[model samples]
Target: MRFYGQQRLFELTTSELERYREKTRELDYCAERPEKRLLAEECREMVTELEQRKNRMLASAIRRRQREEIEHALDEAEIDAEEIIRELEGESA
Candidate 1:
C-alpha cells in the first residue's frame, strides 16, 4: 500500500540569493550616479532595456526551479500509483 505525504519545497541556496541582492545594488548604484544617471533620453532607453533583461533573468530562474519541483512531484506520484495498482492486483488474486 502507498500513502501520500506532504510535499517539501526546495529553495535556492543562500549564495544564490546573495548574488541576486548584489545585482540589485549594482543597478541602484548605476541609477544614482549623476554623471551616469539615466536622465538623458538615450540613456533612459538603455536603462529600461537593462532593467527588463534583469527582471527576465530573475523570473526565468524562479520558473526553472518551480518546473523542476513539479516534475519531481509528478514522478513520485506515478511511482506511488503504480505500486498501489500492483498491491490491489495481488489482493484480488
Candidate 2:
C-alpha cells in the first residue's frame, strides 16, 4: 500500500542523512572551513526536512489504518441492520 512506498522513502532518507553526517565529519577534519560550514548547514537543513517528512508519513499511515477500520465497522453495521430488518419482516408474516 501507500505505507510501502513511504517506508522505502524513509529508509532512503535515513541512509542519505547518515551519508551527509559522515561527509560533515570528514569536512570538519580538513582545511576548507567555509565549505565545511556550508555543508554542515545544508546537512542540518536536510535532517530537519527528513524528520518532518517521516512524521508526515507516520501520520498518514495511522490515518489510513483508521479509515480502513472505520469502513469495516460501517460494513458490519449495515449487515446487522439488514439482518434485523429481515427478521422483523419474517415475524410479521
Model 2 root-mean-square deviation: 2.4
Give the candidate number with the greatest lDDT: 2
C-alpha positional error of residue 50 in candidate 1 after TM-score superposition, expressed in Å: 1.1
- List the candidate 1 regions with Cα displacement exceeding 4 Å: 1-41
Off by over 4 Å in 2: 1-3, 24-32
Candidate 2 on 64-90: residue-level lDDT in tens?
989999999999999999999999999
Q: RMSD, each candidate, Å?
A: 10.3, 2.4
TM-score between candidate 1 and the true structure:
0.51
After superposing all C-alphas onto the true structure, candidate 1 shows an RMSD in angstroms of 10.3
Q: How does residue 63 of candidate 1 score in lDDT?
A: 82
Task: Assess each prediction's global lDDT (C-alpha) against the native.
Answer: 0.58, 0.79
Q: For model 1, what is the error of residue 78's alpha carbon versus the real structure, in angstroms, after optimal superposition?
A: 0.5
Q: Mind giving the per-residue lDDT tens digits that candidate 1 earns over 1-93?
A: 011221111122233444555655565567767644434434445545556655665576678789989999999999999999999999999
